[model samples]
Target: MSAALVLDFGGPVLLTPFELVADQPGTPAYELLHQRGPLATAEQPDQVWEDLQAGRITERAYWDARAEQWHESGGEEPDIRAMIAHLYDPPRPELVREHARALVRDAREAGRRIGILTNDLRAFHSEEWIERIEIVGDMDVVVDGSVEGHLKPDPRLYELLAERLGVSYAEMVFLDDQRTNIRGAEALGIASVWFDVTDPDTSYAEVRQLLGLPPDGAQHG
Candidate 1:
């Protein structure tokens, strides 16, 4: 059966600096936020980020809000806007996996619907960054957590992606590095591949099989 492949940005697509900023257990970023106050106990960082992605807050507003947290904690506030600008500008340090692109090409050529469902920051979706990212190029549907007002594990995000792809929940094959997100997709009856960006081959093997494509070849229609 033909399936819609829903790829994640943070892990399945490419790694970014934000991987640490997220609320991953034992991550230095998460630990730092905890030490910084507000982000630790507050309905914080993640929820605030969701609001930013949902368009409830502008980029400037997000910074201002975050700055307030810094002020309350009396911590040194790095100029994040400046950093975001530098990282996304020309000659950014992003590695586009060659194999991943081939898989996308093969899947599209075989008539499979491809979608990018990501829980990404605002800067990552800027026009300049989007232009540079090839994975987003071949996607039939693109849904961002910030734009959807929902994140993975919430089920709403998957529902929104399904709506965009015009596919049933069961028809979507999702790939994400986070097991929590993978489990979320699984609960929705979506076929899922738990990707470990560190050891991607093991995950890609499952993705290839799910897409009904050969391990290393152009999938013919």
Candidate 2:
């Protein structure tokens, strides 16, 4: 059986929402953070974000708090989906990471199953905008927590992906940006790579090695 390559949607498959907002200053997303507070601004360190990174708070709790703060700042209803829409309305293909796209292409060409396991695809993005994302359609499977009603670290979510992909946990290679999620996959005997957003190339290289694919720029043979 072919091994499956499963990736997290946010930081692995695309430039994280935080990175998108930071890269495009003077945009509505940047202005939302600037006006609201330093939830994302580097100059003004955000304790909430730090806590989330430290694993002191759950990802859901972090977003819930941000939604409340956004509403209090006169943005809109206290829903994370509303906040995500304001930050990433158009959802252009440019939001996807080039390396991620390349990796997926190579993995598919190698005859390996590719899947996206995300906590908030439907929750954070609109159906119209999601349709505009071509990379998402390329996946062999997409297991979304919002749709499944089970988030990462939940064994059932991982099990569901394995079942859908028709692969055993040991036959799957998972990549995610969150340490907690990585640990969860590791606990299930799945080979997991922690995608480092700061240095995506290294992470992709590791994934390539795990998938037994040729190194970047090397001949496929």
Candidate 3:
């Protein structure tokens, strides 16, 4: 019997919000929004994460809405769609792309079946980011939040992925960057690894260790 592995999209293999705007000032998207009066206090950051996880919105809506909020705070409107297009425009970071590909190749060679369980909005569906990151080509099955109308922690999405993969929940190993999402998977009897893609406080070595892989290509015990 083959072990099934389900990987999260935004963190394990892609540039997270932190990596995307590392050089920018102010807090990252994971931070709590400061009470900036009524106009700037329309949405919470966690709500966006939930929406992403719940399949309530797409990535474009998340970013565009964020940009709108940022503009509203300054009482000026910025071209949010254009800005986001530029943000995701650059080439995929080589280190992440290489490592992810290597993992997939090695896992396949090891006879493990792999799939993707991502809470991506429809915006990400059409973005170059998908192709650049190679999500479409690598995974055996992908349960996209926007496409399926179900998201992480919903139980339905996990069931859908498991059903498609023809595996039981306990036979699956899931990985993600968010603790809440991990907890959700745990509830469904899936073993999980947390990928910390954000925070310079967390180095790549830490990520490697968490995944039970070494920085120098050695396998973890």
Candidate 4:
């Protein structure tokens, strides 16, 4: 059986929405974050975000709280999707990580089927915005939770991706920034890597090794 590579969309494939907002000051996202005050910021740590990271709170609950906060602050519809659209309505290719693109290309060159298993592609992005992302088009398959109604750590989601890629769990390697999701994949007998957003190159190197591709700057046949 051939090896396959599956990646989570948010942190592994693209700069996260928080990182994007941080980079672009004077934007609505930036303003919203500033107004929210201390939610995942370096200067002022927020307990809610900490709870989310510590697995005390669900991802959906965390975002639902943020949506209510956004609405209270005079923002649009009190939904996580509304917040996502507000922050990323006009998606740009620059938001896609260059290293991720290279990893996908290398995997393709190495004859591995590539897939994206994301919990919120359609939930967080519009059709037009999704179309603008060239890296997504490079994937052999994309199984989205918004469309499939099943999110990871759900075994069914992993099963769906494996089914689409025509590979067994053992024949695939998965990468995700969230530990819970990583654990889920690992439990299913899939080799999984935790992508560190802080040091992406290291994660990329690990992925390359897992896929049996040449290391960065080494020759590839």
lDDT of 2 at 170: 93
Tens digits of per-residue lDDT, candidate 2, 136-179, equal 99999999999999999899999999999999999999999888
* TM-score of predicted structure 1: 0.67
| Residue 220, model 4: Cα distance from true site in angstroms | 7.9
Provide the overall lDDT of each model, using Cα atoms, as 2-decimal numbers: 0.66, 0.83, 0.61, 0.82
Model 3 C-alpha RMSD vs. true structure (Å) is: 6.7
Kindly give the number of clashing pairs for every candidate. Answer: 2, 0, 1, 0
Candidate 4 per-residue lDDT, tens place, 102-209, comes to 888888888999999998898888888898998989999999988998988889999999999999999998989877788889999999998877778999898888
Comparing 1 with 3 on TM-score, the higher-scoring candidate is 1
Q: What's model 4's lDDT at 81? A: 90
lDDT of 1 by residue, 165-194 (tens): 999987777887666677778888889997
Off by over 4 Å in 1: 18-94, 121-125, 218-221
Best by lDDT: 2
**TM-score of every candidate relative to the true structure:** 0.67, 0.87, 0.66, 0.87
Cα displacement (Å) at residue 62, model 1? 17
Structure candidate 4, residue pairs in collision: none
User: Ten residues in a row with the worst lDDT in model 2?
Assistant: 32-41
